[model samples]
Target: MSQPSVYPSVSPGDPSWWFSDALRAEGGEKPSPSLSGQITVDVAIVGGGFTGLWTALALRERAPQLSIALIEASLCGSGASGKNGGKVHGYWASLAGMAANIGADGALAVARAGTRAQDAIRAFATVPGRDVWWRESGNVRVSAAPAQDAKIQLYVETAKRLGVPDTAQALTPEQVADYCRSPVFRGGLYLPEGANVHPARLARALRKAAIEAGVGIYENTPMTGLTPGSPNRIATAAGEIIAREVVLATNIELAKRPEVSRHVSVFSSYALMTAPAPEKLAAIGWNRDQGLADLRMFVHYFRKTVDGRILMGSGSGPISFAGNTKNPALTTDRASAARAEKGLRRLLPGFADVPVEKVWGGGIDVSSDRLPFFRTVAGTRIHYGAGYSGHGVNPTYMGGQCLASLVLGVKDEWSTLPLCTRDVPKLPPEPFRAVGGRLVRWGIIGCEEAEERGVQAGVMMRGAAAIPKVFGLRIGTR
Candidate 1:
């Protein structure tokens, strides 16, 4: 008998409403068979989420003769890919951070690449039978608090300074009301390159497409052991895969690797989905397919579904200590879920009475600098990509491009892109990282809450919020 797969210990409420609804709409889809016995192939991709699935599809497109097999711990989409709030956009919103890390030219290259990846996503989402609910009405970042207005200014000014004035538009109070009449929204910035999707549906569609392309995928087949060499050996509960190359697209699992662990940490984010309230959304003039978020360090990101429901998410969930991937604070933190519900009441007050049908939470692999990176392991064919922070919906597509080029030994633009070799700042290690991270989280929450309430934060809180910048890091505050 095969040993049981070891799944992540998330909340009972997870796999989320997204996955549940996507499964119903999947139309006679049967679970993929788990791997059995020993096998060898050209490549063995681990994770089976967006990155792995996209890599498989990319590999097939680039080299039809190359054999590929992917293994997943749970269902293909059951990871963070399925458990997110489904906001999609490119790197223009992050131009300031990118430019600050890389140069202006480097930032532009990555942002343009993100746009191409986003275009691909839009095209894939709208194929004849692929009903991924691709809504492309753009995104809004509202200034719910007086202090938060600066972030909106920063995004707009950064884009303009980079000669991409069309990337973002600063909105006046009256202009903001045109999107939605939220009392909390003083003003906002509009970015044209934004969209939303039924996340699980999109992931499932990708899984289907990969299978159609003849990429072997095994669900509920977690890799139990991985020994890297020229021919990488991937041991699993039921079988083993020997492949010439391997792609470690396993999200937060990458945090356990010494090389990766130094540069990344896991932070939880929770979301609340309200029942179908199309009329209430219309009453608030939020009927468009726009995704909206507040300009807080830990933002309140919310959006509407094609079926007229609303999703309100809070990125203020707890952080895990080093190598403690199973922290319940990431998956079952009641305080974080409550904050999301509270945000829905505050931001979209028109839907204050709407019933929240579900509450789900998951972890985000946050980099020292909050951007994703891709590269190969030293002296091995094992390539990896991660640290997408919280804004991964579109970057994962770019990651697929980078990982694919790395595996093919091709030095094209996708492979040579700055993202592949950018020097990501290293995070503080061990006791200091965990202990100081908690203090910073407390400060961020306290500061943002005080600002929302039109008050001043304590000196200690403000100091804590400013601590990361002292060390050339980007967390604790925007």
Candidate 2:
């Protein structure tokens, strides 16, 4: 994932080359000005990603009189929030962990909340002028190997045992082929609660919604420093925001802070997009627009855009050096891009000839538990949440509610959810962290490669794949 320099997202000759261009162009708000002079607010939120935006929206809905200011170093949604695959759904995969960590009742509550988050997004899209490629077509996690098939079956059983039955169901090979004609797909679990979105557009919609909800937003405003106090002061390039409280919902950008960085490890995820090919799509029976993902530790996720282009992304990319959150070189990994395209060709051979329109990558902050957690930073008024791993779209919404409940100091179910505490296990420190991540990632790649070849992974490779789970941080346990 390391590169010589950061790739410019857009160039004079390559406008609209990326899939997110349309959404950015159609975004409702122009960039807000950078913070200037001194400003005081009830709450100052750092990071304009979904977690920040949703927290702001939730705060406003809960208490309209509370003054809120949201500041972003770059444009809102420019980070993982904007760069993600836009699969929104409940965290059915985390039910096992939740039940183990919390009580069964608590786990059920969290699961229900996760499902409600999906409905909330659908409702948000109904707002006039906020259509964000809203598609409630659901998501399917297909298994191409026996191990994956077993995993999906376990997930179905877990879902039912957790009292969220019918949230996910196993699809037979014939049923899977009906929706997508992929030779690799033996079976899958279909979650009707899922939906796909145009992520950038969704972020834009949130920005617009925040503004309409009376939120003060400042773009190009990075929090350079923070001083803990009754009304903590956040220093930026142009000014400082003194707020009664602050919410750090910056996702992988959380690694910018050494303390936060230690608890999370960052890795790059790459995606590739193809030109719209309606004829080719029809030739393969990909008429359904459900989001698809393989069952692997380092998984591949794909879906169709409204324009009919195929978007393929793989999580098997490079791990960042310790505390290197903003390394530009990781933005575009050509090698990972090639692998994603290769995966797309394997899944949909009929569309192999389609021209690739764009390729991009973004960072993921992984916690030792591979789950999102919220907590109040020690000796500060700062509340933070990170470690969404790669399955964040819905969980972040849940994160927003949890953060809002904590900020308002209300004792409710959200505040009681296991994710609301600072109990998430931490990753190992520097050298070991880096070395271990590489080994685990290598093993994941080897195991998946063997699976693709229809051969069992070697004992050493399986052991590598088990390293993360050994620490209870299953890469794609869901």
Candidate 3:
């Protein structure tokens, strides 16, 4: 099959108004070309979203004298960085999964790095002109069924053992009902360190900050290829950038680059935002404003937007290799929307009438172990950081900082984390990749079906409980 198109067409007048509203509110400028062409810089960064912007900012702070340039394929944050769920929470997936690949000690180190990354983002929010809709409210992972309760318990214990300083409390059924306003959740594990953000605004703010700090940024400039040698040269459609070093911050988009395609796979995830939910909130009695996620292999994560709308996200489907090939027929399809809407109603049946005002989908980079891959491609000054799994918001910032430190030849706390190294293995090729993803999706669906039945009966059945581990996955514990 021919490669999928890299650019999918998006409607400018869609009901999904977050991107346009955010751009206007943030006073973001339109993309422009770099004035000085063929200029040499200390570092040349590809991808001007959060990863590249953060990398530039961190590097500037560390080595003020170094010159840097950031090239964007489109506008900054126009990709997944801006379109994500905006939950800047803890580490990706589970520590158990990370430990399975990188060992327990390494996993703990990675978790600590993530925690520090979240702290760093919070600190960045305090800067004037850099503030985005940042709510320091914690995150809660609710159990959709009794069997899933075990998964939450496992997370709580794992957090403690990993030396995570945040409080992980298991809420009782009564507490879940009172706080979450959802009767379907038997309980949940609440962590105090989590936060929600306006992803688009944050990306714009970071790019703005980097530009103000004397970093050169070029937009609508796509890097098509790379030439590695003593000094790396990045080829764009219009021109080439020759710099002492280069960084690849393109997460899922990395699949478009032949050099990095082996290390990343593109997977599509869909999200929906309900119309203003004041009435729904009143009925649910959940005004505390914590980000909520469910415990499942393919999970649902929702959070309250600043405008009082609830953003719900679900659905992980395989997409064509070409980046822009979306089946509009599949966008907000009944089955996918039902996964999110049903999850919301289960938590707050009182809000079952809330209409979904907007639905959008984006792609994520998935690595073999569901952990991020950060490394310098062998014998070259080109450093890369991608494969954040589904947890890119906070980790992207952290990964950027680590990339900055690595480029500067500094060994700091974040740089020392095991995830910063080039140790994680690459995933299998296309056919096997497609097969493995299908198996994972089947396992997750089976578990969700079992839980729905058990919840209706008010007890977990033995047959319903064994789906996750039997399929080589981790489920949170009771």
Candidate 4:
């Protein structure tokens, strides 16, 4: 088979509305030259999304003497980095999941790294004259249904038991309404460290920073093959790259390799953006400008843009068959898009009539454990990282930190992170992976939909939800 594509198949006529808008704001981005003939560099990074760009920047910061080249099948930030919901927060809200996946100490370590990363982004974003549309209001997770309320309780209880009570606190129904009133919501959890940003603009800033720092970027260059050895060789259609060290930060594209495929699979996430409605937003009292979501297996994450538009996203899209990550219809199906719009109308009905200005979707590399893992290829000087799942905006920073340490061969805090050595559970191979994923997905949809309707899902749907338990895997791999 041909090498997997770095970008999924309309992801964005020019990436996405975020990307196109960012480009329009940029007064037209200067094009980067694609590779031609042959070239050699000290370090070669693949996949020009946030992970790859951050790695290049980190390498430049650590070793300015090293010559670095970043290759992109499309453009930097044109992948998930540009297509995301723009929630720029850390893992305080995910404390329970982290503790469950790794140990408490490990969980604390990753959360703290996330904090540092968030701070780093804030620093970069606040630099005078930069326009990433960053807002530091924080995040909220509302329990839209009574069954969903349990998740809010768990997030708070776990944080308190871990002696970080302030990291995540339980909120009353009134408190949740204070942020964004909705009859469906019961209670919620609040994380003060959360923030939001124009994801594509951040991606653009990184691209500009990388170029200014002397990192050669090859856009529209897809690697067709790789030869792993002392001097790794990466071949593209028109040129090839030879480098002493290599980094595969190519998101779901890495899933093409069995080692990664067994641990990570692709699932589509869709987002719907409403036309600017500052008045509609005010009517709902959603003035806090925080990232908001409902507690569900396939969560609905929503946030406001600088232009007064609300972007609502659903993580409940279908699983790719046989690990085929390419999203033919921009990674969306009619059902998923409908669910996203349903989330917007059901949760924040104030904007129910707001015209949807844009719709975009893309595949996310979800790990078996729902957390990312970083590792070096066995007996090779190459590093790879993926499985961001749906909560990558903040963790990709941690990814860059960890991957950078590995490339430098430095045994420091970042290099020794539990994520670097964790043995995440492996998902089933092909046919079963995709087939089972779809079943569980339907199960989750059935259960959540029933809960929302104030009823119990049928036995069959509930049993499907329990299938992951039988296989000793985390629920909702889809």
Q: Which lDDT value does model 4 have at 131?
A: 93
Looking at model 1, report the run of 10 residues with the lowest lDDT sum. Answer: 1-10
lDDT of 2 at 394: 87
RMSD to true structure for each model, in Å: 5.3, 3.9, 5.9, 5.0
lDDT (10s digit) by residue, model 3, range 267-378: 6666777778776776777687688888766678888877778888874544434333343423434455556666666655665666666666666776656777677777
Worst 10 residues of 4 by lDDT: 1-10
Position 154, candidate 3: lDDT: 73
Rank order (by TM-score, best first): 1, 4, 2, 3
In candidate 4, the residue pairs with backbone N, CA or C atoms under 3 Å apart (3 or more residues apart, or in different chains) clash, namely 12-15
What are the per-residue Cα lDDT tens digits for candidate 1 across 255-342?
9998898888899899878889889988989868899998887989999999899998999999899957788788898788888888
Worst 10 residues of 3 by lDDT: 1-10
lDDT of model 3 at position 435: 53
lDDT per residue for candidate 4 within 1-478, as digits (tens), equals 1121121222334357798888898888766999998999989999888898888888899889999999999888888899999999877877787798798998898888889999998998888888999899888889998898778778878998998999998999999889988878889988999899999999989999999999999999999999999899999999999998999998888888877988987888888788899998888888877999888889999999877999989998888876686756436476687788888888887776677877788888999888888999999989999899988878888898889999999998888887788888888877988899889889989999999999999999998987887777874732
lDDT of 4 at 331: 66
Q: What lDDT does candidate 3 reach at residue 223?
A: 82
Order by lDDT, highest first: 1, 4, 2, 3
lDDT of 1: 0.88
Q: Evaluate all candidate structures by whole-model CA lDDT and list the values in order.
A: 0.88, 0.79, 0.72, 0.85
Two-way TM-score contest, 1 vs 3, winner: 1
| Candidate 3 all-Cα RMSD | 5.9
Q: For residues 1-478, write the lDDT of model 2, one tens digit per residue.
A: 1223222242212212332574446753468888999999999999998999999999999988999999998888877887778878877656666676665676777778888888888899767777688887888888977768788777788788877778789899999988888767888888877788888778877988899899999998988998889989999998999999899988887877766776788887887778899888787788887888888767889988888888888888788888476665456566676677777877777776777777778778877666678888777778988888888888888999999997998988788887775366567788888788878877888888888888988999889878866777534333
